[model samples]
Target: MTGFLAAVLAATVGAQAPGDGADQRRRLVEQKIRLVDILINSPAARGAAEGHEADARALIEQGHQAVDDARKALADGRFDEAAKLADDALRSVSSAARRMSSGEGALSESAQRKNLQDLGDQVGMYRSSIEELAKDPQKGTGAKALLRRVDGLTAESKQLAEAGRLGEAGKKMAEAYKTAVEELSRLRAGQEVLLSLKFDTPADEYAYEKKRFASNEIMVDMMIAEGRAAGDKRRLVDGFVEEGRRLGTQAEEQAKTGQHAEAVKLMEQASAQLVRALQSMGVPVF
Candidate 1:
């Protein structure tokens, strides 16, 4: 049952643990399933069942090709690009799901049974993927709430599929997937912000980075802002540049090592240091 869901998951989720290519393979499967769904929804699908079957087969083939492209991207460390390929495959699948929700391919009871079973399988696959993700120390990547959210949605989808209600199940699944993707994007952005703080000479903490070269204090006044990783107070002059760059490097290293949140925190510190140094020099960092 989990055969196809695994593939779609690969595309939707962030990069896997360095060694687990299995996750990538599974996402490819999801793409293939989606391609089948697309062909089934095509205009030619309903009029001639034979034509629909052939087209479905072709879509499946195309989906596999897309998965391959995504897998290569993943292995190459192009996480953002890999994510995009996965998105394309997922979109293909979603398109088919939308058609199904609209009752495009109203099938006989026997066919519906086969289809529901496939959906059930997909649900199972998603559940497994979620479980695997749970093992990662990071609870949530961006929104810091993805794994829990996805798990709840996966469970609901499984129940809907089991009840032989593919349309409702698909809709719920779609929402869940969308949420996960949104969170992933957030996580990426947050990682970019980790450990870095910027100050402009012309601005206080409340007026940070207002314009291209706005000035701010070297140390963060707000608890929401990142503070120095070590020590307290601001640099008297441009003397803090070394400390700031050190923090930035640490943040980048952490991000590269998959401690995305930690990396950002370190980076913010570094940025703040640079801000003070630039201000002392009477230069703009923007």
Candidate 2:
């Protein structure tokens, strides 16, 4: 059964189990333990850890042990003890996960607002970086996929905050930020290889230029797309993106004319222009 159904079943059984059979109570407790286990081991939970700090790991481990003890109690025909242990274990797991999710601690309203604003700024930076990274031949699709997940999380964060679920919203925002950081790390690693390419031979130089040209073409397209998304209010960003595209075109033309070194320089200029555009929007691309 789904976790939701399992939760409902546990609640229903708990309410009526005074008159119901001991076996039923045991099953309900087991169901609850199972649900908690699933939640504690989910990707969202792991991401909430930031790096699985010792305290967080300890709480989660304690919950697991409690659940195990609960199971043993149930087997020994101690229904009340089993149920209580299961419930307590579930709460422990949930509290730990919630604590980790918030990234720091529970935020007051003003703090939440400030933190949200900070996270939003980080998200904007990641969004800009993703636009450039998604043009890479090797890591483009992966970066795009990660950006989709980050977008979903950021949307959820906004929805939660709107509904006055400030604590929950903070957690969601933290998770989104963590995900974006991971994506940025990956994107940087991928690009570092290309950026480090040495033109030791004429063939190697030609290959580097060709690959760089293709990558810059995609980057130009992404920069344009970002500009359009920002609309006319961001005319300055649009100008930067336009200039970047122009430089990309010039780079390609220079490459065709066997001016590979100049072509590389133009590509660097194009990338800088795009980065400047993002910085103009309060996103630090560097």
Candidate 3:
């Protein structure tokens, strides 16, 4: 949480004084109710509900009920009851927010595991490609250093994962994957590699690019939701993602009009923008 938001929450949810007048207590309770509403309607809270996080959903529902009861108490001139109910609502809202925040942490851990798995897969793919290229001794000549670095990074990532430092593990794995990709790109600089997929039609190519673009967009969304892109970077990353979505929309329209070739190009551009967005959030993608 940011300092600004924490300060705001503190101010809104402060304890009522014993000497406070009825109107002052009422206003404080109302502020708390509004804060609860805002918290429960936030994107994270909504996502938790959508994901079937039972505890969070139940808490949010409980908060809503408390808010309703508090409003009724306020109307009936029961200031003490309204204050208590309002506090209940605030407690439920805070619990729900914490539950959702914990869920985000779990999600981050899961994503880190996936990243490690993906890095391992990319390493295998690159090794296989290198072996095939080695058939012509001249093709795989200059990749020894990069190959060693990738191996070292992959090993270190595994060690970090074993130590339960998944965040560090993911970063190491991303570095490994990026290194492998760079080496592969270097090896295939002049001639197309045998591993390159051959598409039978423009539509097939478009489908492939579209899938890639969607995957990249998903990564960008996850990073943004995790608050990885914040402050100044948030705006820049959002811009890239928005541009990517625009390009993706244009690509879909072109594809619908039987312009598969153009659609493929547009989708590729869209995917590139999404990749940039991820990179801006310090995530590596190939």
Task: Report the CA-based lDDT of candidate 3 relative to the real structure.
Answer: 0.68
| lDDT (Cα, tens digit) per residue for candidate 2, span 101-211 | 445433346645655665666566567778778887988888889889999999999999999987678668766865675557656763452223345865456445443
What's the C-alpha lDDT at position 7 in model 3? 40
Estimate, for each residue in 1-286, the C-alpha lDDT of model 1 and write its tens digit.
1123234334444433334575665554443433333333222233224325343334434545665787778677665566667666555444343343345543334444443343344334344444544455674342335667776886887688788775556546644544443344344443432223444532232222211111122111110022222232323432464465456556656656667556555655666665665444433322
Residue-level lDDT of model 3, residues 95-205, one tens digit each, is: 666654454322245545654565566566676666666566676556655666778998999999999887578667656765665566667677755667679999988
lDDT of model 1 at position 7: 40
Question: Which stretches in model 2 have alpha-carbon errors above 4 Å?
Answer: 1-17, 47-50, 105-286
The full ranking of all candidates by lDDT, starting with the best, is: 3, 2, 1
Two-way TM-score contest, 2 vs 3, winner: 3
Best-to-worst order by TM-score is 3, 2, 1
lDDT agreement with native, every candidate:
0.44, 0.61, 0.68
Per-prediction TM-score to the true structure, in the order listed: 0.27, 0.34, 0.41
TM-score result, candidate 2: 0.34
Model 3 misplaced regions, further than 4 Å: 1-108, 193-241, 245-269, 272-286
